[model samples]
Target: MGKITGFMEFRRLSEQSSPVVERLKNYQEFMPRLNDQEASIQGSRCMDCGIPFCTTGCPVNNIIPDWNDLIYRNQWKSALDVLHSTNNFPEFTGRICPAPCEAACTLNINDDAVGIKSIEHAIIDKGWEEGWVKPQPARTKTGKRVAIVGSGPAGLACAQQLARIGHDVVVFEKNDRIGGLLRYGIPDFKLEKSHIDRRIDQMRAEGVEFLVGQDIGLHVPPQKLQDEFDAVVLAGGAEQPRDLPVPGRNLDGVHFAMDFLPQQNRVVAGDVLSEQIKATGKHVVVIGGGDTGSDCVGTSNRQGAISVTQFEVMSRPPEQENKSMVWPYWPMKLRTSSSHEEGCQRDWAVATKELIGKNGKVEKLRAVRVEWKDGKMHEIAGSEFEIKADLVLLAMGFVSPVQKILDAFSIEKDGRGNARAATDGAGYYQTSVGKIFAAGDMRRGQSLVVWAIREGRQAARAVDEYLMGSSSLPL
Candidate 1:
């Protein structure tokens, strides 16, 4: 620890966010990174705990205490190195990850946890500003070639790792641009696209080729990749959104969160759609209380929606968790995102019964209050209600990956329809079909970006071993 008593002396310092009034007018990142001194102070708050539970808590197992000590000692470059050693994209996680590491912090048992995410954001931003982050191209080239499907975090991570180890890597994206969900699913207000753009540039410099609008199963034959490349990695994320199949679901204004979100992202990226879904001057109802739903609320407000309301089928969580019982583990609790803070009417334990509409356009939503009893949900008597809703966005999360890609590869699938692959032991990450590997959401179902990166890195190592009969890359 840099300072033994630092945790007792310092309080957590959070990043500053732009005013809601000023930020709603545009789609741009509002949270500003902490200055050096502020970041150092936050870093110093890391306690001298015997074991850093934060590392185990993180999906990528980042060396939190080491970086915290480095930041406190004014070693910014070293901190960035340590950060990058584990996380391929700290900027993405620093901005959007829920920071379960902080929840598992020893100090958080009774006191505020260290602002690890803020410190990470500062380190990475500083690294870029000082030209510390640069291309790490392999000195020698291997004859082997690898094909990666999907340009999201997992695919990008896998490609970068394989390329750095001297293998020829080509990433194929179905969309016109790289970054699967990051490019279109997320709003710019939370994460700017420039971060992904810069990484793409770095990857290209590292000899990773990217081909857009190349759907492996649809446009391009899946057999071509298998024939050309030594191995194929499936990193495509789960895109099968869960649907609300109630009455009037076929209404025109009702759409999946993916359907509505990507259109706004494309528009922001200067793509003109023939017909775009907008929340302007309309009563918006976003179903499902998750990050996607919160994003809808933010996007709706930005589009000048008359009102924005969010619903959750489950009961509301406690404002605070019992740390004594759930220490060193992620706890279920109420989490209000920045979007929720901006403006939103949030309700829980409410289920939609039907969508009332006119002329094939959704007009209102009929729902009812329900309660959980004996592990089953029971509708409350006389609690039915109707609310004005011109647009309904279903953000209930994804169920599995698109089955067509799996079918094209003739790969075995798990019971949940995801590509069947293991994460440990021999032939790990290898699909039942030889020479094919699956990682991230394609293998593990829908998950966070950090988990995807972890799987991607590990999958890269697995592929390296398979190709060379051994590998030195980190697992």
Candidate 2:
């Protein structure tokens, strides 16, 4: 659609990452952006196929082909408009999203995807540089107030949408900062806090008030919000981290990944840590070979760890996916993150049996290689071994949202312990309580930031319609 023969003319060009040695020195963004011309060439590779499976592949249902075509034609402003129409924060998704959209791109079936993610990143970055990104205050005031709990991506997106619709919105966060997980869980190297800061500034300019250090269900009663605001939206993240309940789980050097990651992030933000968990000079063993574990590896390397090792219970994924069979859908395959590129030993099909330590501190990890047969994991005989470890970070992921917080609201929960809410049909996202609503991880459980944004925007529409009997906001 862009160049007619663009797909045949141009090949995919991805953003370049900084050299591993240089990037590992400090916690900063290392991905180098593409020049405008280079980005255009990549964008032009989009075929704009009739099916356009990339749209469905993206969690936010971004208008991928339209923007790709616009970018290829050097219509920067129009491309930005198309991008902003669907995703409130293309910048965030462009940087950290897994980009399943590219995986599902028709071009990917035969060759590389059109470098869609990089093109998107370039477009948003350009928009910001050109001062084209600005606050969009509602033209008319609705005079209705809404309270949003948790200022993570979900709450922030919901508040932004509600504010854009002329509703008075206030986001309450328990932490001292506006961003929940984004400000804490993610490292500064991956996503600098300034990105979040500027967006918060924009939201504030749009009439969305943020209240940091305000815990809705804790210090401030949930009933208070319901009474003060016309409607209340719950967007608290699922933060109950899954832990390894092994013999030495209670040891001093062992900790949850959430507990460990936030401290490092805070320290990077120039906050003085009283008791920072440092991997300095220690042999670090990170359990769970997910993104979080990879993050730990990077952080530990930065901390000058003697050695870093990551463990995964599941069998290793294939080096390459059978594209013919899994095209247009996310396929399981081995993924090595930038952090992994720096340094670390990754082991799969290995389960930690117990933590061994002396003097009440974690010292070693005892594990065994496992073999799967008939849907069961069997430990191999004589496969047990011990790895030296002074620190252990459990990054197995989250179990559910903090139950006590939800319990404070007396909200009904789904079988998964998330807030019971529907996303389809009219009256969607309404909690058991008449005036209450739910979205994001609190409603759908732990998920990607893109999914949270989608849920938040949709829930905003639901709440808006419920309040005024009509809504012009897009779901």
lDDT of each: 0.95, 0.91
- Shift in Å, residue 333, candidate 1: 0.4
Off by over 4 Å in 1: none
Report the Cα lDDT for residue 135, model 1: 97
Candidate 1, overall lDDT? 0.95
Per-prediction TM-score, please? Answer: 0.99, 0.98
Count of residue pairs whose backbone atoms collide, per candidate: 0, 0
Q: Score residue 46 of candidate 2 by CA lDDT.
A: 88
Would you list the clashing residue pairs of candidate 1?
Answer: none
lDDT of 2 by residue, 30-89 (tens): 996788999888888889589999999998899999999888889999999999998998
Error of 2 at 259 (Å): 0.9
